[model samples]
Structure formats: C-alpha cells, structure tokens
Target: MEILDWIQDWFKDNCDGNWEHGEVIQITTLDNPGWEVEIDISNTSIATMNLAWIRNDNGKEDWYGVKIENQKFTAAGDAGKLKFLLGLFKEMIDKIEA
Candidate 1:
C-alpha cells in the first residue's frame, strides 16, 4: 500500500468510531519523494487536523503533524524512522489535552 493509503487506514482504525465526519483534507508530496497528508475533522464537535510525513530510504526523515483542538490533542512524527506514528500522536494529544 502507498503511504497515503497506510495513513488513511491508520486514521480509520484510530478515529474512535468517528469516521464519516473526519476526512482527508489535503495531500502534498515533496520533491524529496516525501509526502504529506492532511485530514480535517473540524465539522465534528471537536476540530481535528492531521498531517502525515513520508520519507524513503534516504537518511532524511519527514514529519507529520496532527492537531485536534475541540477534543484536545496534538500529534507529529518522523515518517522514515517510526514503525507507526500513532504512539507519538497519542502522546502529543495527551500532552495537548492535559
């Protein structure tokens, strides 16, 4: 699966049964062959924002930043190095909400 597909799947799995309102808003791919996927779930009671970072085999690492204000959460991760960014994301969200 492509990076975007993987990210979408991840989000779907983690959306906490809030899938229809949450959506992938924008996707931007970099020249470094890295990619960014943005998800907007603002329509819900809580505003949700997600960014995905993608990097290839090179030493460089990309970043994805996700923000959720209404529900209280923030997220980011290095795509090239981490297995899955969910841990980082949850931590970030907890910090923001806390």
Candidate 2:
C-alpha cells in the first residue's frame, strides 16, 4: 500500500524513529464496501494519538473521512487534513527527489 509505505518513510525521515514501533491496523470494512484504517502512534512520546480513515460510501471514490481519537474531523470531500497527515511524509519524499 502506498499510504503505508509513505507513512513508514515519513516516520523514518521526520520522527527519528519515534514511530518505529507504530502500527497500521486494518479494521473491519463497512457495508458500503469501504475500508477502515487505524494508525497507532502510541510509541511516540509526542502524544498518544490514534488516527483513522473511513472510506466514503458515496460516489466520491477518492475521498475519505478522517477521525482522530475516534472523533470525526473531516468529511470525505474535505481531504485537506488527511493530506496534511499524509503530506508529512509526502514532503520528505519530495525533498528526496528534489
């Protein structure tokens, strides 16, 4: 999964192994045939945070809803926050390429 790889690389680059013991758990799929992803960052001292992604059942196939600490923050079409989380890694990858 590209997201997994990107997350791992992000930790390696930005977190200084703080997330070395982190895990990405695949939670149950909803009836909408959407995926649920759980990201654990408890190993880091920064904060005991857990993030989640719920694939939207609507026609917006590329969109996802985001949750932090089980609290819904962003709707499917509003991916800015999600991208910010993913962008932490994407920025590093971009630097490497630059």
Each candidate: what lDDT?
Answer: 0.45, 0.44
In terms of lDDT, which candidate is strongest? 1
lDDT of 2 by residue, 23-52 (tens): 433344444444444444343332333446
Q: What is the lDDT of candidate 2?
A: 0.44
Worst 10 residues of 2 by lDDT: 71-80
**Worst 10-residue lDDT window, candidate 1:** 50-59
Backbone atom clashes (below 3 Å) for every candidate: 0, 0
> What's the distance in Å from true for residue 95, model 1?
1.7
TM-score of each: 0.32, 0.37
